[model samples]
Target: MAKPKLPIPVTLLTGYLGSGKTTLINHVLSNQEGYKCAVIVNDIGEVNIDAELIQKTGVVTQKDDNLVPLSNGCICCTLKVDLINQIAELVKSGKFDYILIEASGICEPLPIAQSIAVLEGDEEEGTPAICRLDNIVTVVDALRMATEFGCGDNLLKDDVDEEDIESLVIQQIEFCSTIILNKVDMVNEEQLGRVKAMIKTLQPKAKIIEANYGKVSVGDILNTNLYNFEETAGSAGWAQAYDKDEDERNEHHDHDEDEHEHHHHHDEDKHEHHHHHHHDGEDHSNCDHEHGHCCHHHHHGDDDEEYGIGTFVYHSRRPFNQEKLQEFVNNWPKGVVRAKGILWFSDKDKRDYLYVFEQAGVQITATENGKWLAAFPKSEQKKYFKEYPDIEEHWDEKYGDREIKLVFIGQHMDKPNIIERLDNCLDD
Candidate 1:
């Protein structure tokens, strides 16, 4: 009756080119805060170059320090064949407490997940997994999402063929468990709102964190232990991957009822339990691909077409009635697959602190963030605004960055009503 040993967290960082994956990697390595961390650069040539840059931060080099560079970095080269073996080698080294796998810009991240998915499951609850897949963090450049990764509102634009790189970008967004909307500073408010809305349509299940230059709190990305095999495999492109496998493992049992019950699973299921929206659990049992169902995975064909979806942004300087805000969050109207930003409450206790808001579904939870810049004296304001100049755009000389700014996305969202409801909550 031995308890399973804790599985070390293995985080996979995926993003398109110039999406700030390396920056985030550098940040993690530079500010490891004494964690015996190991960085595994799986991309072909980028790892060497990126490693050099990371070393420039004055952190010891992995070659002489804490990094491991792997070959076959090209997408065309060997992929799944030796990836697991390489991971096993790192695990055996026993030199690190946490391991980070950075996916090349071109490679699909799901295959990387399945390579580890075989290890996580409730059936193996008593037996520790080789490594727990902590999170599939995708660093999306907000500016690029609009200009480069033209992901419209549609999650499955299967009717239209897609170009190679464009499709890959969309797939990466859809497959992640948490998405870092990096490079937020590069875009204007209008562009930022559109990009967030587009992302919501593409991957409503992924928890979105608005980040600038990958300057996200380390606690948000690593060691959170929020990865759930059953729940995570619900994104549009990778939904039902593990569940389909689980059903096969239990063939003798009557999985038919359970299968049918969730066969038409909606986005609400994924968000109901957590922020990320769930996909329809349609059975692709007929898929014959060697690596589970291939229907949802993108092949990135030549005829990629842009999706046409709506986006809405609400920026208000007034503080909200705490009761009204909470009530609206509890029973908000349908739609708004993704809603996230900062909230300002009128209540004395709540007003002093910035309330961080992120929602995958109807359920929205507001947690206390650090104080608003307005709370600090004018002389000390530069220290706060130095990192986020964008905050200064909306900063009131008297109020500072104290406002309820939320970006919401849905199918032809009732933007006006949503705006009105929020405005109604404001104190006179």
Candidate 2:
């Protein structure tokens, strides 16, 4: 019998933290019609929570009958060795038709793609065949994006740079043939419009798909190659958005920056600033609406250069005052759009802790602890109380204490002032 094929196509699923890469991979693997698929999971940080979640789905195949988990450093960086070994083993197994590799959160997808592309000659004698680049599909958290990047929520950690997150998202888009905008259900009409507009600005060539819980056909995820680095290099959101002449006609420009600034002068006001004025004369007709979310490209010229300031903040330490923080949220800056992080509240009611992803002035939804307090039944609550000696009597009936960990995305936002204000909001 002839050799099956020269090289199999490998699909890459990558995104930043909590952007739903694992969710998408699980969706594809579970819904696969007949394809013999092999999945490789790469996780970051000390926890392999995503890897465990995927394994629980029963979609992950074993390596030499042993489950392969690379959960130390980033897959694109320190874990490349494990990544290669596992993929090679999967290929040699000769049981899979397609291979799906999910990169760790904070990983750069280009290196992962380059690794697969360059490994064509690494297959040993018994290995099925080499692997080739099929497609790089990057998932973006639409709701998180709307609150973090589109709106400019300056609630990120002090040291974290918001620009890095924007640049990272753009880089992921640069290499992807397909871009999955996940969490479409989290935004309102206006917030959705900003999210799509920003995505179109960043990745114009990619075939954008609206996804909820990473639900997209596996076929679309595989066997597609829309990557053209030459074309994508200069034309990505960073450049071409403001240069469209046809769009220039319907666009409106206001010279009054002072007027926009006047609306955001309050120091502790719980609201956001808004400077991108949509004039009535401007025809937003060409915009495409996917599930009521309007998306269109922008012509980036002097206007964008004047307005686009990518900022990110990474803060590991600090506790936030709930009341002051809520007031800050109530008066968030308009230029500052999105922010997602674990929040440590200091209030007697909700001081336990919570995760926050703010978009369009709404803090999406906060989840309760599932591990400790939430797991105990009413009858077992007293018994479980002994397990956690640190639990306060009143705190048990209230909430669980988590932490304030968040990723902030902002555009043209004042980093210094934002950080100062956030620091002030926290306990001394």
Candidate 3:
């Protein structure tokens, strides 16, 4: 039996508009770093502007077979099927050692990653087995990071629908494995430090690289092997906060159980003893999210607080009053940079669906994700219960697994006040 052919590695490049993605693509394609590379460029319209720009640089030619341009729509949404098909064709050719995809500026990285992940010879579409996603690299506009983050700007284009620039920017940053802080020369050291700190709070797992003119070593961006679907999926700072809180809770629970057993064996002792857990004066490590009422805060460091950057996770099982939730989002507290999570609404028509709530800058949206397990018949819910027995622990007689789990990351976050506002939005 012959060994299976290894999948060709592909690097995905994503960033906000004017973040110098085109310059970086040119750099990667021109340098190559001993690997034969094929470039797939996605642009907003029929013009294929980025590809043309790269072509003008003389690194790649328009007539070159290696340059494949995907235009007229964002790859993450409208052009997803085309993206998979293109990858299949590129892998089938076997002419390139590496493939690079430049996602449109307004696109989200998660969908692109999901599309590639599902192509492991499982779906009806004849996706080639010889393609593997290597890394997701997000380019950041260092000079603009400080100015545009909470400026309430929209990425509007003649060819594409308007999108919240701030939210899209943070989303791109949160889901990437490697972040290129491009155009660093344009910002002073203090400004750059703040930007780096902000990125750290948003995505602690991503590696940060400073660059000028979108220039970075091909070695740093290509074939780094940093893309792990599970890890990257939960790599956002908010997700990490929830994971840390759960871990601490489990540890505390075990400690309590051990203490209980010890007390049972020593009931005769008249002296009262208490086990106190000290946090070294930092209260950020505590998990307060219980019964949909806890706010889990993150401790980045002293400088983090000085910069007013903080992260908190809000968890609740209660469904939100749709009108109240909307009002709260519209009047979100100052210093909120980004907020995203699964939400449950009390509207009768919307009760069956789980909404994905997101707020970036001044823009907020709640889109239907899918039906909640509680909306399904008991027989249908049994399969999920068998697969994940822990689901029963969070299941409510009325709501099942439907809950509100949101994470907010920003500067000077009023965690207690935010929690109160969110609680007010919940249906009693």
Clash counts for all predictions: 11, 45, 5
lDDT of 1 by residue, 1-428 (tens): 23224465788899877788889988887787756677767665533666566567765466653566654463224656466766666666666667787777766776777776655535646754667888889888788666644323332233223325555666677677889999888898877777775666666567899988788878777887766755655554222222333334235323222111111101132322222323332322222222111111111111111232433445555678988887777666554555555567888777767776766432356777577667767666765467655445435544455655454544445655676677667773
Over 297-405, each residue of candidate 2 has an lDDT whose tens digit, in order, gives 2223333334463324323223567678767777775555445434555566554334443332233334432223433455555554476433333231233323233
Q: Which candidate ranks first by TM-score, i.e. highest?
A: 3
lDDT for model 3, please: 0.75
Instruction: Please provide TM-scores, in order, for all candidate models, with all chains considered together.
Output: 0.52, 0.53, 0.81
lDDT of 1 at 229: 56
Off by over 4 Å in 1: 1-6, 58-60, 74-77, 118-128, 151-163, 237-428
Candidate whose lDDT is highest: 3
lDDT of each: 0.59, 0.56, 0.75
What ranges in model 2 sit over 4 Å off?
1-4, 63-67, 121-129, 154-164, 228-235, 239-428
In candidate 1, position 165 carries an lDDT of 55
